[model samples]
Target: MSNPNTPKEDDKVNALIEKCTPILKKMTFSSFMGYCGGLTAQKVGRGMAIVIGLAFFGLQGLAYNGLISVDWKKVQDSAVSAIDTNNDGTIDADDLKTYWSKLKTIMSNNLPDASGFSLGFFYGLTH
Candidate 1:
């Protein structure tokens, strides 16, 4: 006895599945290498190395030619200020402690480790 609502598997479904076939294509390493080599040869020019080097390393020349401005005096002043924290006439352990204390206070207030927020806020305000 079979239920009226249940469907049964048939031979026609099996015959249709048996008549179907899949086709596959094979690839070779030599063909892939040949294509890569052709692309490299076509895209890479003789002056590419020189152009890339100049683009990255030529900024020194631009700076020398006055295309850029660098404040040497400001850099020296900052270096001196970093060493002289109390603005006193000496660089001692007290200055070092003052510098570290300021750093600790800034770090704790910002809670930088808990959130990924940086001192970029202060940087933007100053700059």
Candidate 2:
């Protein structure tokens, strides 16, 4: 039997819900987007970090075992080429502008709430 003086779990939950209900009701669309986008970014970021970490370790293990060979020079050259827009042999402001434009295009094409998400994404990354 439960203690008569103890608070029930359902009562605690109900109280918590009551406390949050007004704040939730007061949320606006932009604020809602910001909250959801930030939450999504945090979750996705953690997931991506884990996946990338596993891939990096897996690739290293394969290379160490002679099952795969990574051409470091090719990889470096491709990475440079990707960011060195205008082929100036240097990554500068113009390359960054190009990268931003490409990112914007991708965001618009893929996301229905790109602007709000972008704002929240930056906020999320910083916080």
Candidate 3:
């Protein structure tokens, strides 16, 4: 009773189901791994500790160099006029965050893909 050129509805549904089943199975496995044990939680805690330690060390080094010892009032006033791109009277962490965020975005967008040029140039520059 089906048309010669057209697939049956069950055949289409089965094809779609076949395409998605592996993806669903992989996601389920990953979720099970995430929630079934303390191992993932411990790893995340260790990673956060490492990041915090590195930030502390970097701040300490900056302090020793007098780089981060500027007067907060003057720095805030200067930063308000200088970095306030939208001219908003209030300066918040979001401004600095967005600046670095844009830098990362630009770097990623403009960066050349893995090619022989970069490797060759690095080798030439080093040697």
Top candidate, metric lDDT: 2
> What stretches of model 1 exceed 4 Å from their correct place?
1-62, 89-92, 102-127
lDDT of 3 by residue, 10-100 (tens): 7877789889998656443323332332344456668999998897688778988988864557756895889876677666677767774
Scored against the true structure, residue 107 in model 2 reaches a CA lDDT of: 48
lDDT of 1 by residue, 2-115 (tens): 885554466675556555523112223333333443345335643687786685466657778999866657755776777897787567799978864664455446342312
Compute each candidate's TM-score over C-alphas. 0.25, 0.48, 0.28
How high is the lDDT of residue 76 in model 3? Answer: 62
* Lowest lDDT block of 10, candidate 1: 114-123
Question: In candidate 2, what are the lDDT values of residues 43-117, reduced to their tens digit?
Answer: 887999999889879988999999999886787688788879899877889997887677556645645566755
Worst 10 residues of 3 by lDDT: 29-38
| Poorest stretch of ten by lDDT in candidate 2 | 103-112
How would the candidate models be sorted by TM-score, starting from the highest?
2, 3, 1
What are the clashing pairs of model 1?
A: none
Judged by whole-model lDDT over C-alpha atoms, candidate 2 comes out at: 0.72
Q: Per-model C-alpha lDDT, please? A: 0.51, 0.72, 0.57
When sorted by lDDT, best at the front, the candidate numbers are 2, 3, 1
